[model samples]
Target: MKKSILNLRLFNSQVHSRNVESKEKWLGYLFGPCGALLLNAIMATYLNVYYTDVLKLTAIWGGAFLVMFPLASKIIDAVTNVVMGYVIDRTRTKQGKARPWLLLSAPLVAISGILLFTVPNADLGVQAIWVTISYNLFYSFAFTIYNMSHNLMCPLSTRNTVQRGGLSVFNQISTIMMSGIVVALIFPMAIMPFLGVDKSKWILVMSFFSIVALPLTLLEYYFTKERVTEENVGKEEKKIPFLVQLKVVLSDKYMIIMLVYFLIYTIGTTLKNIGLVYYCNYVLGTYNDGVTQMLVSVIGGVPMGIGIFAVWPLAKKFGKKNVTVVGFLLYALGSAVCWMAPRSLPIVLAGQFIKNIGGLPCAYVFMALFADGLDHIEWKSGIRCDGMAMSLYNIIAVATVGIATAIFNALLSGAGYVAPELVDGVTVAAEQSKTVNDVITFSFVGLETITGLAMAGLLLFLTVEKTIGKKQQKIREYQKAEALARGEEWEEPEVKAAKEEEAFFVESEEIFRQELKLKCEKKGLNYDEELQKHIDKVSLKRKKEAEKKNKAKEKEELRLRRIEEKQREKSARLTPEQRGKKEEKARIRAERDEKKWQEELLKGEAYRAKIQAALAKRTK
Candidate 1:
């Protein structure tokens, strides 16, 4: 039986490891930022040029279309995310949980993103509408579907928190690298030329970019994994509604805060994106200055990514909230420096370098707290609720980007910059040539202001209290163990309730988990290795332990029944012989029961000791 149990676990572990490599997980990671980089750079940064210079549309019309692309998509993105979240929460597959949608959405997303830019021919209004509808459809369905299924890959379906964190890091790096290539390389090389001359060339360049980015992004959806396990899954009979899921997620303080942050930040992005082309063309007097803009893109990321590494250590030392505060301050200060720095190219570059280099680290890791916040809700509400939690994050992110563009367009039009009518492939006359620079500069300053405000909103997110330090984590881990002992899902509600009821015990558990975690970190032991060892050792004996306990309970009940029977016999006047015989039987049974209890107690203690020892080894 022991051998069979060991074999079963080994088989399960093997299956889990295999499941970890599902195509969707990696593919989604690769696609999300790469595609974001490509689409945003083109649509946000250069689409105005395409409209005014290439297609020969007026700024009001051109800007209106570009703005509406994201705005129109915002509604669709939200609707799609809610729908996908609902569908994913109810998803099941023999291939393993959420893999079906995750695997399938790649091609659809790739095609839609490409189609938005690759449309052949149509009337201007119709073309604009087509682009708007197509972009919205692609991102709303394809991106949301892919991301919802992707987040399900967390919770160690076949791995652990450490593994998930590692994956997050890997995904961040992979996506950012692609962003660098797309924004830094692609724009300087291709789009700037398209902007310089020839309306026909604009379409040709966009088509080329769409081809390059679409395939690169599709590779991500082709490579990611989706692992599966027993989870606090909503019942098949009582599926969660889309609106309810959206409502619940939005109700979360962190989710609301994230939405605010993204919304505000998107405003900054829109201004910054529009500012880029305008600054190069009108302010700096050459679209060929794309290099400086690319520099800005590269600089923005370096500091943020670097800052992220420091966040974990600082979080361990202080708290997630404190570290985030420090990050926000550093990032904001840097942005201020970059924005306010004088017109010297060297000075601006220096400011940009410092700001981005400082900001990059935090961007990579600190936002993980957003996901961690869901644990508090799970503990409080007894729902794992990944789809709702993650969807909220994505929705805010997508919506804000769209919102930013709309705000930018409104401001641009208000500033009296009409789009140039195209003459062949070039603008017939400059656009608000005299005042465009002022608009560009003022808009940039506003961008700085909005980004700063959004970062402040991110600071408020620390209030959620899901940032479990070492102490709380230990307590939760023990309850998790207890649930496992009772043959319950580790993430189930009863386990959380059981732990919540024992405050002192929980405090001690947390202290223990912390000390051990610190010790492991000091020893440089990987969390994944420790977790894998534990999962490999856990067994069906959890159910067996519950059964043995139940049997012991039954024995006590039987003993009480015998004692009551003897008392009844003794109550009869002529029943002395019967009472005496009953008493004798009762005494014999009691003695036998005592012996059995002692033996079982020893076995139980031994079993618990075995568990403790294994846990110690894993943690140590």
Candidate 2:
């Protein structure tokens, strides 16, 4: 039962490393994401401003680059993560299957984090294009490493549902925390100085601020331990060809849903966030990034922090799907309000608060929901697929992000806004102004529709509530106990089947009852006391079924009758003369039913004879 003597020991030989694992795991998740956040703060939020205002790139092209770079990570994320996931599933490593992926990739993530933000001071034309290509490549690669391992760790860290929820929630807190630092601080400090607004050394200033994200990421690797089993890990797995792997991964329904949702939500959100800078500058007539970003942070930040906690509790109570639907509907509503609101800052701020409140619960739910999929699939197939599954999901998620970025970039270009060539002033073509408005309107409406789709997906999740209920916690414990006895890691279908007979019996009872009745219902077969008892059993069951069905029919009839009565009253109002005709038809229908009952009475003898013949054949 100890960690060492088990079939696999990838990450650690120690079973009780709460002390060592605690801090190390915490930091591993932190450093990578925080670093990514700082990088994104520079890429997603500030880069457009820097290109337009400082570097004087054209709005169309600059916006295109800004949107395309981070978005390109989607393509990079899809392929890399799936490969890594399959590799992890098939890998045999002493450091643990996932740790190697993380350890090797962690530094890359940090390096890429820095690269994405570090722009060359070369002239606008060539350098802008080069920077776009380079930043996206680095980000795509870095996030692939970080997001895969980070996600894999959720399943690896603990098997308990409650513990998973707790872990997922806190990690999201890390997401929010890092997001705050990225948008609120990193953007203005790193990109603004070079625009002739401040005299600070932008490069060193950014590196210093951005480098702080690394230690936080490294912490995740240290505190977290990978829990692997022989069943879960396979050094000799049939390495799937890339095309086959891609096909199978895409076929997973849950993965596709999450993928689409991520694409829509991320793109919509990015458009809204990036557009805020433009909205404040031109529409509201202010260039103060600090005030605008601060206001956004307060509106968005506080709700996000609160949402992480709120979602778990509400999901536990009402189900994760219900809460997510409600949350998204709120998001849809907020999107509409903001789109229609006049260019007043107060109205916009109010809209943001509403949107943030609606979005908070959903942001945390999808990550934790993956735990449910891991259990349900294993239970159904007896095949361990968390690695490939996670990879497939991540790839789609990343790709959608790519498309969103691409769309936003295209929107900006079509708007015809040119990036500011001079140090302190930006030139806006009429097309640019028109495009900005269209982008805003599109974002508000488009995101709302996606939210509706998200709600529909959440409904599909409801069926699992009963079968998998309260069993996620027990399943993990059972996994370890059975593996200990069998000298393996995961449970084979035979092993899992032993624990599932209770469920099988419950499902099969009705069929068994019917078979028993068929044998008992024989005539002239020298029936004994045993036959009599069985007949009693079948009769009682028949009575119960009939009673239930009759009750349901009665209720349905009552509802229909009420509806018909209302129709009758409404029709009478339309044509007073038609009322007598309607009453005549009702009387004819009653008389027809009475004649059918008399006919049934006349046929009773024939019906009894048929029953007798059936009994004789059953006896024969």
Give the number of the best model, judged by TM-score: 2
Please give the lDDT score for candidate 2. Answer: 0.58
Candidate 2 on 385-489: residue-level lDDT in tens? 667777776665566556665676576666765543333344232324665766645653446546554654554544443335434544555456656776765
| TM-score per candidate, chains pooled | 0.65, 0.66
Per-residue lDDT, model 2, residue 473, is 42
Measured by TM-score, how close is model 1 to the native structure?
Answer: 0.65
Task: For each candidate in the order shown, give its overall lDDT on alpha carbons.
Answer: 0.55, 0.58
Residue 378 of model 2 has an lDDT of 45
Residues 279-320, candidate 1: write the lDDT tens digits: 655554445555666655665456544554664555545655
RMSD of model 2 against the true structure:
19.7
